[model samples]
Target chain A: AQRVTQPEKLLSVFKGAPVELKCNYSYSGSPELFWYVQYSRQRLQLLLRHISRESIKGFTADLNKGETSFHLKKPFAQEEDSAMYYCALRFMEYGNKLVFGAGTILRVKS
Target chain B: DAMVIQNPRYQVTQFGKPVTLSCSQTLNHNVMYWYQQKSSQAPKLLFHYYDKDFNNEADTPDNFQSRRPNTSFCFLDIRSPGLGDAAMYLCATSRAGKTYEQYFGPGTRLTVT
Candidate 1:
């Protein structure tokens, strides 16, 4: 079974500071990685997927196959960026059954 | 707007009682999923409906069952709720067959006492 690991349970940063949320996965086959976010009092939503290679809300993650990592990154964090983030891995063959990591709560303070 | 919806955002049920959580979608998606999430824990996949077929995870307790009468509707039934069943249940939908980006509902909070 594929599994995702999010090393940090909580990450705190000041506004305008750079932030990185680390994620690693254990899967032998080609994996499709995604970042999902849940804001306070909001439903969980897709942030970005590695397949698209497009950044959303100034956040981007690069898939490092050798390292088995896909870390969410932003050059400068904003207060609005505070939320819970989850890393997920979708199997190439499985029908949309996602293996999610324990989420990391990102806190951006002024 | 096409979206996933879960009703009764909050539910409270007595221990060993039966409770049902409803989910419906306007997207007509063929895949619907039920996930259980505890505070500070990852959302665990319990089961999903692929078209008219139902698939349950191996570790999922027998207490939990799901019914999808049609493409637009699905229900998660807990036969006998326990204190440990208290958690947020999330419903998600996706297109048929592959790992498509899934859309999630606001989630239903189930509290067992």
Candidate 2:
């Protein structure tokens, strides 16, 4: 079974602080991992993908196959960065279906 | 700009009544998907259309049906919505490939009364 787990329901941080949202997956096959963010009154959009190996809005995530984890990290948090973040995974052999984590709400306070 | 569009940002329907949610895309992507997201829960895939090929999830209920009339338009029909069916239905589109990313719409918040 393909599953994603985001244990924290909320992660509050002060502006300029480093932030990290944890994500773990249960899959034996090669998987494509993604991080999606939804801002207030905005649509859900892609923030980052493991395949691209690039940072977006100063956030980056690295896939660790040994741990089966793809954790999202940022050097410094901003007020505009406060949003709901979801970690998703796609099974390579499963017709390209996406499986999402429960999500983590990042509240960046000044 | 080319993007995915979902009509009726908010909807209110009586229990056991039928409701339909519409999605259209200007990106001309080859794949369209329908997802149901409950409050505080991750979005769950219900069904998707790869061009004209319809694919349904194994756990999807028979009451939930989808139709793709053309390349740009797709519809999700709930034959008899229940109270538990109230959720935000998300529409997304992607090109047929392993790397192409999916673009999501603003989503429709369905309220079952």
Candidate 3:
């Protein structure tokens, strides 16, 4: 079975500080990973994907197969960056059903 | 601009009553999905339609049904909603195949009284 795990329920950081949200996955076959964000009063949107290898809103995530992890990171956190973050995985063989993590609520304090 | 739209940002229904949530998209994406999200929990996939091919998750309850008449519209119908069924129903769409990113709507929050 494919599963994504995000152990942190709430993460607090001061503005301008670096931030990291951890995510891990378990799947036998090759998988595609993604990070999604939901800002206040906004719909959940894709923040970045491992396959894209690009940063969005200064957030970057590196997929590590060996560790079975795809943790989201940002060099400096901002007040506007606070939101709910979810990590997801898509099985290569499955019909593209996305398995999501429990999600972490990031609160950047000014 | 292309986007996914879900009607009734908030919905209140009596227990054991039937409720229908609607979703529409202008992106013309070939794939559409419905997910149920509870407080502090991950969004669980209920069902999805890929060009009218309906697929239901194994763990999804029978009371939860979905219909997709075309590429742009999809509807989720709960035959008899229980208190446990109250959650935020999210609608998302992705382009043909698996290369494109999924776009999500603002979601419909269901409150069962």
Candidate 4:
């Protein structure tokens, strides 16, 4: 079965420190990956997609096909960056349904 | 702004009672989806509507049902609310294509007693 895994349930980093949220997936075919973020009391929003290859809010993710990973990274963590991040895979076979990982809670402490 | 909207930001219901959560989108997307997100967990796909065609997840409980009256509106009906059903219900919309980037609404948090 195709599955997306976010190994870190919670990650804490001091402000100005580099941050990385690890995401891995198991799929037989080409995978379309995305990173979604949800801040406190805010609706979930798309942070970035692998196809877009664009950096948003100082966050970037690179898809490593050989490793089957798409890890989200930021050069310097901001206090406001504290949020829940989810890694999702688009399952093309099932009307392009999004299968999401367990998500990582990133806490950037000041 | 073109956005997805879910009504009743918070809902409380008694056990075995039926409740309906509504969603509307101004984006006019071709697809709408409902997700159940429990605390400290990832959002789970409950069902979706491609235009007017409904698709339910294989593992979705029979107690959950959905309706899309038109392009801009969708509803999630829980037949009998249970304590385990307490969670945040999210509504999202996307255009039909290979590049399916979904836009989500501010979810409705459901509480069952």
Candidate 5:
């Protein structure tokens, strides 16, 4: 079974503080991880994927196979960065469906 | 802009009533998906259409059905909606080879009264 776990439901931080959203996955096969973000009154959008390995909007996530985790990290949190973050695992044994974690609400207060 | 689009941002229907939600995409992607999301929860995949082939999740109920008449359009039909069926229905599209990155539309919020 492929599953994702985001332990924190709410992560509050002050502006300019470092932010890290923890995510862990359970899968038997090689894993493909992605981060999706939904801003207030906006549709969910792709933030980044583990395959790309490129940072987007000062946010980056590294896939850790040994630990079975892919935690999203940002050096500094901005007020505009507050949004709902979801960690998803792409399972291909089926038709390549994404299994998402419950979600984490990151609130960056200014 | 070429993007995924969903109709009726807000829909209210009586319990046991049949409702149809529409999704369209201008990206011309090969795969389109429908998901149900409840408050403060992850989006659950109901089904997806890759071209003309449809795939339904094992846990999906028979009360829900989907259609893809063409490549750019898909529809989700709820035969008899229950109170539990009320949720945000998200429509998404992605290319065949690169199905990892999905483009989601503004979801339709369904209310079952």
Candidate 6:
């Protein structure tokens, strides 16, 4: 069985400040990781995936297999960046199913 | 633009009443999934349909059922609504092959009375 964990339930930061959302996972085999974000009044959408190796909306995450972690980071948080973020892990054997973390609420204060 | 759509943005049901939520997609994707999301929690996968093949999570309760009459439409049926069943039910779609990126609908908020 695979599981994802997000230690922080709420993370508040001021605009223009650096922000980091921590995520850890437990999986025996090779895992695919992703970040999904849900903005106020909007449907959940993909933020970034480790395989792409590209940043989205100034945010990036690197998959650390040894540490079993994939943390999302931004150099400077924007007010509009406030949203709920979820970490997800996809096990190849499970087909299309994804195991997700409880999620963390990112609140960017002006 | 191609997109995933869900109907009845909000639904209110009496306890033990049978309720069904609908989802449709214009993207013509091969996979459609149903998820239940509680307050401040991650979306939990209840089941998914790949073409005509239906797959349910092992831990998912038997009270929940799903139907996909065709490639473009799917339905989630709650056999008997319970207070704990009240949550935001989301519908999502994804293409087959190596790309696992999924498109999600706005979701229907179900309220059990």
Best by TM-score: 5
Which segments of candidate 3 are over 4 A away from where they belong? none
Expressed as tens digits, the lDDT of each residue in B1-113 for candidate 1 is: 88888999999999999999999999888899999999989999999988899999999999999999999999999999999999999999987754457889999999998
On the 0 to 100 scale, the lDDT of residue B84 in model 4 is: 97
Q: In candidate 6, what are the lDDT values of residues A1-101, reduced to their tens digit? A: 67899999999999999999999999989999999998999888889999999989999999999999999999999999999999999987887678789
Model 1 lDDT tens row, A2-50:
7899999999999999999999999988999999999998878889999
TM-score, predicted candidate 3 vs. hidden true structure: 0.96
| TM-score value, chain A, candidate 2 | 0.97
**Candidate 3 interface RMSD, angstroms, 1 decimal:** 1.7
Query: Model 6 TM-score?
Result: 0.96
Cα distance off (Å), candidate 1, residue A110:
1.4
lDDT of 6 by residue, B1-113 (tens): 88888998999999999999999999999999999999878789999988999999998999999999999999999999999999999999988873358889999999999
Model 1 spans with C-alpha error above 4 angstroms: A93-95
> How do the residues B1-113 of candidate 4 rate in per-residue lDDT, one tens digit apiece?
88888989999999999999999999989999999999877889999988989988999999999999999999999999999999999999988873358889999999999
Model 2 clashing residue pairs (backbone): none
In candidate 2, which residue ranges exceed 4 Å CA deviation? Answer: B98-100
Fnat per model, in the order shown: 0.78, 0.64, 0.72, 0.67, 0.78, 0.61
Runs in model 4 lying further than 4 Å from the true structure: none
What is candidate 2's TM-score against the reference?
0.97
Give the winner by lDDT: 5
How many collisions per candidate? 0, 0, 0, 0, 0, 0
Q: What are the per-residue Cα lDDT tens digits for candidate 5 across A1-110?
A: 67899999999999999999999999978889999999998889999999999999999999999999999999999999999999999976865889989999999998
Q: Candidates' lDDT values, in order?
A: 0.93, 0.93, 0.92, 0.92, 0.95, 0.93
Which scores better on DockQ, 1 or 6? 1
- For DockQ, the strongest prediction is 5
lDDT for B16 (candidate 4): 100
True-structure RMSD for candidate 4:
1.4
